[model samples]
Target: MAVSLGFASGAIVQEFYVDDDVDRSIRDSVEAETGQALVDVDYGDVVDGAIVWWRAEDAEEEDLADVLVDAMSNLDDGGLIWVLIPKAGRPNSVRVGDVEEAAGIAGLHATTSTALGQNWAGVRLTARPRSRR
Candidate 1:
């Protein structure tokens, strides 16, 4: 079996796994739920992932963030996960910085940049070790 990792957002801690397809089903589900398009980046074998962005909703960002964190935690074989919440001035305008911050809030280590390429990029957060405490 693959190594399991512990993930957290605020008070929640859950197990996670890294899959072969890098959690494509999560992307598809998010797309179907939000009716948004997703983009994939070439991390060149060193990494494999995708990004899903959509128009902002009346829902609070914190609520959405919680949903995203829980989704990542529950996703089958999911390790590297990124959730972006950019300004809602336009559709699919999730800035890399926004995603980075959300990843951070999810207690994930990440790096991002719009200059990297495309409107979106793959997830940067990977499975992290559980706290000793």
Candidate 2:
């Protein structure tokens, strides 16, 4: 799990809105593998990496876009941002297309995606480079 999530020793990672089960699994995996604890933070807190777990049906598309914008605001340069959603065909699962569209609206691109676990899948994103004046 840590390897897939790209968690590293001493890397600052934060989680937002992830379920307890998933969060515990990730935290324990990271600690066990890297011997480091992730720095968990709420929305609006800046950090080097972040994980956002949300059920697509829970919020409107616009709301999800806002959440992504806020999450991006808190990410550092060259940082990783992970968006985890319920797998397709699962109850209340979010569509991959919706997630990708929201990411584009937030000025990000989906670099990779993988199955997170039995119940969820993850999409990896990185901030778009800023345009110079």
Per lDDT, the best of the predicted structures is: 2
lDDT of 2 at 81: 82
Global lDDT of model 1: 0.39
By summed lDDT, the worst window of 10 consecutive residues in model 1 runs over 1-10
TM-score quality measure for candidate 1: 0.39
Give the alpha-carbon lDDT of every model: 0.39, 0.73
In candidate 1, stretches whose alpha carbon ends up further than 4 angstroms from where it belongs are 1-54, 58-64, 75-78, 84-92, 112-123, 131-133
Model 1 error, position 75 (Å): 5.2
Model 2 residue 68 CA deviation (Å) reads 1.1
Could you tell me the C-alpha RMSD of candidate 1 in Å? 12.6
* Model 2 agreement with the true structure over 4-74: per-residue lDDT tens digits: 57755565677766555464665576566546566555535556777778786557543777778877776
Question: Could you tell me every candidate's TM-score relative to the true structure?
Answer: 0.39, 0.80
Clashing pairs in 1: none
State how far residue 107 of model 1 sits from its true place (Å): 0.9
Best by TM-score: 2
